[model samples]
Target: MRDYPNDQNLQDLQERYHLFAHMDAAIIDAERDKACPEGPLQDLVVGLKANIASIGANWSAGLRHRIAITAQSDAHLTKRLRDHGARILPGLNMDAAALGGGTDNPDLGRTANPHAPDHSAGGSSGGSAAAVATGLCDVAIGTDTLGSIRIPASYCGVFGLKPTFGLIGRSGIVPLAPSLDTVGILTARAGDVWPVLQALAGPDGGDTDSQPAPAQWANQTATPDAQGLRIGIPQQVSTVECTPETLVALASARTTLEQAGAHVETIDMPEWNPAKLRQKAFLMTEAEGAATFAEALGTAGTLPRTVERLLTYGSTLSAAKLVAGMAEIRAARVQLARSFAQVDVLLMPTTPQRAFQADAPAPANQADFTALANAGGVPALAVPIEVAGQALPASVQLVGPAWSEPRLIRLAMVLESAF
Candidate 1:
């Protein structure tokens, strides 16, 4: 069994980084009793985002007023992890109500990037990625709604997998956008993602969004050959104003995949405008989030002003605007599906830049490349790129069709081995 981090080290790290929103001996003990000695994850320690439900732990979802709300039962995925022998930690910190890209919460404070203390750990799932990056936990579970998981994973230089939509059950997870919220895994190494994914993925009767595994995935192997793989790079990616380092990292990835016998081509996606689509996704999230948290909003002082303002805007959106946003999102999904017909996978930069200062205002385009996957209901894997002279890590993502996690993971492994 892998050893847990020493208590002193764990406490010091948490103090310095503000990694957890709620954690204590009680939370640990509650999870310990559920561990199965002979299970596959018997030795693993897992951390969950504040929004994911774990019985006996606080489920604040980063809201100060909601801090008293404790989960009455384990979420479907949490139960599976315990059954597989993993010990759950208390909830990690996140952006207020999971509405932002940076993990600076008005209630929970900020999660510092393990790689660089002054920099932001990418959001909603920032605490999850930081825990894995700093060895506080072997794996961390996070919710991704428009790059929440992958963004922090990139900033922290960890492997984050946002599996195909509906591939993982979402019961007990606080809903951000019911249509886009997905539970995903983050780990220090790429190899760790597959096993954990295998253990937690399956249909849950309680989660209406849960999907059954297709027959072809039953016996599918994680080892996928790169030869003859068709890789597509959307033409719009080249036009995006990425930092020089980010662009270099992306070029390196393209070259590496090509050298590995994967056929790389630039393809046109005329209907997909990342910046515009991202706005549409934001609107959907806000509108859906407003509906989900309607009751909470009525109680003044229950949430921060920023969160209240965003949700209020969402609540007041005209029916015509909401319908238009939904229509745009549907079009994005169709555009992505059509792109998939020509390539086995779409490769692009995960974020347009590296980790910025925690105190800095988040860029508006952070989710440009990632939101489409959510809108399209596809799977995406974000892996850190090691640039020769750069101190901060750059990252890229591989997007595939719905239920194509195995293929995306396999290809990610190839890139992992090469890096």
Candidate 2:
């Protein structure tokens, strides 16, 4: 088995993504008390977002404890994790405003690209991706409005799942794009993804958006194994900044699956441009986030600097623009839905590139690949295949229509097994 080194390994992991806030030694203590726990996850430490509301140590507490500037522990989520016999470690952070800078929490600050530490880990969910990739935690929970979850997963080279909207509860999580916001998970492998998903998903009475998910153990009747799997790869998505190594990673995976008797098709979605769709997503999310925080900002209370600026900018948005953006988003969603109807699963580059250096400053443009799912309200996953030379990690994104999470996961499971 391949083992990543531990000398600065955690720090190296911490630098790769921006979602983790802090680690809770106490959480580990709590886990040790459990008897006959589940397999690997029985003793796993999971990171969460700072905005999740919990009764014990929270984002504010993390700051004071000097554990993390952005790591927040949701009292509610933490309590639930305990009830389920799981431990809640510290929360992770995105950039100050959950904007472009990367992970939050100044002390735990932005994650360095695990491979480099100079580039970005991706946003909002950067810490979560970083934590999982570096083995800081078995799995981490993140919130996705635009590309918060998927982008960082891509950049950091890991597996991330954004379930269909409303499948997972959002009561205790932070709000970015309210309508678009969904709880997501990041992990090292597909098997790990399902376990965390099982724990965190399903309807919660506390969250209004929570809806009843399918039976946990029952397999969806429609999706079969890789032998009968029909996958779509959008041609347009490949036109992005994908390098030879990245392409090889995906191509090799595709070839292996093909050899295993899975059906692979090159899809053409002339209407799909991940970059353009993401721009609209950004505007819509910022506008909605502005509205969500309007009251808080109206007061003289201070928010993280990035959040403050985001709110201020949102304040400037006109109702007309918001309405127009929604209309456009709706159209895009319809188009994407129609596209998905042509195939059971769609695959694309999780990120156009790989991880950058940990200590490096923010790049000019970020969150490009991860925004499409948010715009379309579809379910997606980012699965890492390789951490090639010079670059740390690279992954492939699998997309499915809304409410198709079960099917998506099954497919991901096959891919996981193949790899």
Candidate 3:
């Protein structure tokens, strides 16, 4: 299980990639001693994104004021991974308070893209994606309150899965918004995802949001046989907004899936007005996040500008507006369910554009497509797809009905083959 690096070299890797917020060799060794005989993630080096709790690691969600905070007990996800024999290398960096898509944390150093070092790694889970893409670890666990996992994976040319809300318990992690937060994984390959999910699924007595798993939920296979599957490209994604490069990548992926025997169709998702949905998602996320960080409200001035702005915006929202926004979200979910009734999956570019340069202000358009998954409480997978002449990676998201992780994984397997 100690296959990757010695303690000294792990530090070197961490510094090279800005992948970890805090790391401890002794804690990793202790977990190895207690590791179960044979489990899903045995011998794998897994990087836990900084916000999720690990008893001895820094649990700061990349804010300067919280840098000294450390977890006294393992988060539910941490315990599950250790029991399955996964070695926790170091927790990765995230956006300050996990509010943005860029992993530009002023507290911990920015996590750079392995493909293009000067480019941003999509975040707030940027470090995890960077770690996996750069071979610093075999896999990494990350949270997605709003496209954090998938955006970074897309930026770093790796695979990221945001499981359905409540599919995995959220007992020990810090919350950006409990209603939207979910634990997920970033890996080098599509085939590596299901095992980690298997180990983490099931109700934890602690998390009030935990849900029962379906029979054989973890037994679903991710083989590359996509024959006869219906793949729907939403009119929203197919028509406008995505960058020319992202659209090209999407076209290539669609063609590849068709060749693999999947039936492709263009479907109308008129209810999903990107602009309106974006506004509603912002209102609800910021409001919930403001409440989540209520204790830190006074210290908001110490946070990164973007994060502070979000918290302030969230705090200032009218409760009546928030309530109305949530009602629209519920109705949107129902509409999404009806659309999926005719198609097995709805596909779109994970972000409208690729990762911006490290120095650029994080783009406002980054989360336009992905927050829908969080709002709808469905599963979404971001799979890497290659562009014709670009060195960086672009990706498309595969979204399925709630509890349809198995199906999404299988589709991701098929889509990833295009690269």
Candidate 4:
């Protein structure tokens, strides 16, 4: 369906972040010795985002405070993993300050597409996606505010889920847009997600937003054999923005679901003005980001050009406009939730477009396909759908009512099963 590969693609997306900042430092020639001492995660190596804080370099109050936040949170995470038996690798960087800009690391070479080195690895979780896709690690953590997790996942041909906001605590993650920011995971296999999810799904007490869904919700009610799933296909998604292969892949995925015994239906939604919605979305994000990074912005004589500009733009949003945007989001969320009542999950093309050139800056309008979930406080997962001769993943976001991650993941498992 979608085909994105090669060195050109990689070179096309390197303008954003420093990709080399985070990678595996320890190299093991072979698997761990069978007789070697092992713990719970003895077989796994976890990748941390540079934004997360850790022991020596830990400084949550620094100019780019994300690393410190992650390091601090990871201290607990590391102990828990070690007790269980896992190793925590160094943290990776994102578009500066997690702005979704891509990376600039030269050695690893800007987190380019693993399938095709010329293309890009998506962001702000680009590095995480790169790390996982390349088999450098079994699992890696990322932050999603809007579509950070899903976008890169789609680009890199991996599995990414932005759990219902608050389901995963953000105490240790950097505050991109604190209200919307959520910690998420990227993995090779669809089923592999469960282990990490189980480990980090509960509340941490510090984040007022965190609330794990009940276990019963984790067991999906919809059974494939009893009857087919009621999947809603949004009509608004049919357009030129989606490449031929993307459309084809989505159609094929739908067909596969049907063959698997899931029922599918076509649904219509409030037509959105992509540009206006993007503007409103940015207002909320930039404003929240400005507040989150206020300390860094105030003390630092100068900040990264892009970050400073974004922060400045965020600062200019009038309180009145911000309030109006919030109201719009709340009202929209209510309607969207009601819409889900008729369908188990809603399916659509994740980005409707192909991966950008690796050397180019992240598309200014990149978030169009992924932000609604953040606005709605729903859980959405991006699973790799078929692409072209090569594999280019088209996203099918499954969003359920608040705290419905269990159901969401189950539904996604079925969709990804075809691949």
What would the TM-score be for candidate 4 when compared with the true structure?
0.83
**lDDT tens digits, residues 1-419, model 1?**
34565567767988899998866666666565653666778879888999989988899999888788999998999989888888888689999889998898887789999888999999989999999988889999999999999999999998889988888899888888989998899988777887898889888988898898788684677774578999999999966779998898899889888988899999999888999889988998989999998998888777789989999999999989888888888988888889989999999999999999988999888899989899988889998898887768999999998888888878877888877
TM-score of every model?
0.97, 0.82, 0.95, 0.83
Encode model 2's per-residue lDDT on 220-320: one tens digit a residue: 44232567767888787665766676787789768766776778899887766666666666777778777766675775544655566766887788878
Residue-level lDDT of model 4, residues 252-311, one tens digit each, is 877877877778888766644444555687788889888877877776544566677888
**Candidate number of the best lDDT:** 1
Best by TM-score: 1
Whole-model lDDT per candidate: 0.87, 0.65, 0.83, 0.65
296, model 2: CA deviation in Å?
4.4
Query: How big is the positional error of residue 140 in model 4, measured in Å on the Cα after superposition?
Result: 1.0
Candidate ordering by lDDT (highest first): 1, 3, 2, 4
In terms of lDDT, model 3 sits at 0.83
Off by over 4 Å in 4: 1-42, 57-83, 104-109, 218-227, 271-275, 299-301
Candidate 3 local lDDT, 33-55, one digit each (tens): 55454677877888888888888
Best-to-worst TM-score order = 1, 3, 4, 2
Candidate 2 residue 199 Cα shift, in angstroms, is 2.3
- Which ranges of candidate 2 are over 4 A from the true structure? 1-41, 60-77, 104-108, 215-224, 299-301, 357-366, 387-391, 417-419
